[model samples]
Target chain A: MKIAIASGKGGTGKTTLSTNLASFLAEEHEVVLTDLDVEEPNSGLFIEADLVREKDKFKMVPEWSADECILCGNCQKVCNFHAVIQLGEMIMVFPELCHGCYACSELCPTSSLPMIPKKMGVLKHFRNGNLNFVESRLDIGEEQAVPLIKQTHKYIDQQFDDNFIRIFDSPPGTSCPVIEATKDADYIILVTEPTPFGLHDLKLAVETMKELKKEFGVVINRFGIGNDDVLAYCNEEQIKVLAKIPNSRRIAELYSQGRLIYKEIPEVRAELEKMKDLIMGKMKEVVK
Target chain B: MKIAFTTKGTNWSSAMDPRFGRTEYFLIYDDEKDELSHYDNRDSANDAHGAGPKTAQKLFEFSPNILITGNGPGGNAATVLEKTGVKIFIGAGEMTVKEAYEAFKGDTLKKL
Candidate 1:
């Protein structure tokens, strides 16, 4: 089963929860901790993974040969993205605006358009014991993370069958990149706190998952610190509270020192173990 | 020649509203004549994407030799305007239409 741990607000315990959950599950199952948060992935910090493979991700842009230029404005008309342009005697393509749809090339009368690859990012695969850590890093100054995330998912060697347990640590927010990461998730775990910002963004995250028609559960980290608004909302909405980790400075210290919470707090491991069973039960309920 | 400045709207109704998309009160100062004239653009509503070619087509109706805006002129829009021999000034933040005209006459219109 593919599980996604996501949060709409940053600084929520998504990475913390994902790291411990993947590590805890790895002992009994063939696990893949895929960090889909390409922009700022930190899952590897917790897992002792060695980089095994690296590959480049590319985006497509329009390429026109000067010799075949008819200067017809047809290419410019069909581009819904406003990416193509027809100069007096030339056709030019902007790398950023092109969505790689190739509509311009199809519409060009001279058939002068060809796709040129624009390198966007790199994908790195790491193996540590039983767990596989996959991360995609966007190139510096690159604006798009969608292609890289898609590339990372595509590059995974495993076929999409209900076999191994896969936990995806997704990027924050309900933006396009977040949507890209969580779209194919069979189950979504929204990690949130009891803070006001957490509750506010949690609603957005819940709404997004509802829109995507994904079965979701909430995990409240820092459970005792903030107000009860999140619990109140979850109760009103009938959203299940899967697990809760009380706010502790020791947990925060362990996290900053790159230690998994379950590894540090023996009691936390038991909670995560129970959390996994709860998740399994919830998944069965939804699928049935 | 007259040009119009209309901010993007919030909804379909506002976007389609003729009063919201085009301005008839635009004043263009002809450098040679040293006088402001009523400049209007009536086509901003017809185009979507709000960039490149669509924007150029809307601005072309005003017969503007120059365009000043925050977004850099380029892509399909810039190419079309340049084909008509119109200069594009990107990063024209907070500058009113009259100020842009003065900047154009003084040869200070920065190219995108």
Candidate 2:
């Protein structure tokens, strides 16, 4: 089953939960861990993986051919993005503003515009013991992360095996990139804290999950530090609380040192193991 | 020569809008005809993306020889306007569209 670990707020332990859970599950299952946070993929930092493959992710953008000799302004008129502009005899194409929809080229009477490939990011595949790791890194100055996230999922789908357990470490927040990462997953695990900020964003994430109609559970990280409001809210909403990792200095220290707490803390490992079982049971329930 | 000013209202008495792309209206004054007209910029103002270039395209229809506004146009819009031979004049902050045009005619506004 495919599972995604997401959070509405940043630094709320999405990477921490995802990397540890993936490592814990890899002990008993064939696993593929995909870090879909192309803007800042940090899950790979905690896991030891050898780079096995790399692929360039490209998006098609329009390129104007001024030589075709038409300044009809049709391309500019058709572009909703305003990436195409006509200035007397010169036609300018701003690829950065292009959404790659090809509306300009489609509507151009003279066919003066052609869609061209623009490199957006790179997808890297790695192997560490029993786990296959995949992550994407967007190009510097690239504004769009959704396309890269989509490309990463497409790669996962093509190489996915039914026997392997898939884990996606999604970007934080309930925005487009986060939705792109977690949309197709069999289950979603929202990692959050018990603080007010955490609870507020968690409510938004829960709303987003409901809107997407995805079955999701909550994992309260740093459980001992804050009030039980998150638990009460989850209960009120009929959302399952899958696991709680206590607020511990050791876990925080290990995380700060870029180490997986599951390897060092048996309690954390056990909690994650229980989470994996719950996820399997939940998937089975859905299958029924 | 036709002049366009990003404004908050349809008349020359309206304050020049600080934002070019998201301005509420563009007041176009024709020098030859000595007439003033306005185009609603609400569509460009509410555009989720490319408001600057889109607004520039909308203003291009008036064939303005100069554009006067509180601030300069954005990069994409500037590129289009520059290529179309429309001279841009900025620094009309807190001034009415008529005053800004008067400033432009007096060569007091900063050319951008």
Candidate 3:
């Protein structure tokens, strides 16, 4: 089953949930854990996976040629990214503002435009036991994470087989990067806390997911500490509460020490298993 | 010796004169004799897009001795304005039309 574990807010244990689920499922089944949070991927810190492959993600930037000399301003007009500016007899490309769409070069009237490949980010994959942990890192000062997420998903799609249970750990919020990561998942696990801020963002995420027509269930982390607003919202929206992990300093301590919750609280493995079963049951309903 | 400022958004226009990028204002100044002129941009609204080329063209029609803006003259805009041989100043800040004219007249304004 292709499952995506996402959260509306950061530090809600989305990575903890995703990594543990991957580790537990890998014991008896083929599982792949993808850290789609390209900004700061922490999945590799816990999972003792051996590095096997490293791939660089590239974005297109304009390469100017002074030999073919007409200082036409067509390239400047076509650039929506504001990366290109035409100077008298000279054209300059700003690598920072570029999204690598290549629209500038393609639309340049002077067939003289050259498209150059610039490194936007890097993707690294590691393997431990039966699980594959793939993580992406965007270059410093790069604005867009959508391309990195898209490229990582493409890598997963190429290697994914019918049998492996793929679990993607998506980035926080309902922005473009988040939308690109969760698209086409068989099931989505919306990991959220019970705080008012969490509940507010959860509604936004839930609305976005519903519009995407994807099946999803909510997992409330630190349930006892915050109010019952999340549960109330869930009940009102008829969204299923798959599991509730109570606020535990032990879990937080274990996580800070770079240990999975299932390792410290092995009994939580049973809970995850049960949650997996519930997700699978919903999957059956979905396939029907 | 009226100086025309480009009513566009950029460091180039601001570099030349204070009121270059400011909305609802224009800076017209004479540095040698310290004379000043002010015009509201009520007549100019479409200046942000296309990198101040058309707006610079419009300002040049006013026959200013010096042009101040936040962007430098490197593109076709520079080529078009080179014919007038007007002094170009890039990277002017938020000096009011009258304030910039006074600065130019006082010869205290430094080129950025």
Q: Per-residue lDDT for B20 in model 3?
A: 34
Give a tens-digit lDDT track for model 3, residues B41-60. Answer: 54435432333343344455
Better of 1 and 2 by TM-score: 2
TM-score between model 3 and native: 0.76
Chain A TM-score values for every predicted structure, listed in order: 0.91, 0.94, 0.93
Task: Please give the CA lDDT of all the candidate structures.
Answer: 0.72, 0.87, 0.74
Where does candidate 1 chain B have its weakest 10-residue lDDT segment?
A: B11-20
lDDT pick, better of 1 and 2: 2
Winner of 2 and 3 under lDDT: 2
Model 3 spans with C-alpha error above 4 angstroms: A282-288, B1-112
Which wins on lDDT, candidate 1 or candidate 3?
3
TM-score per candidate: 0.78, 0.87, 0.76
TM-score of chain B of each: 0.50, 0.95, 0.52
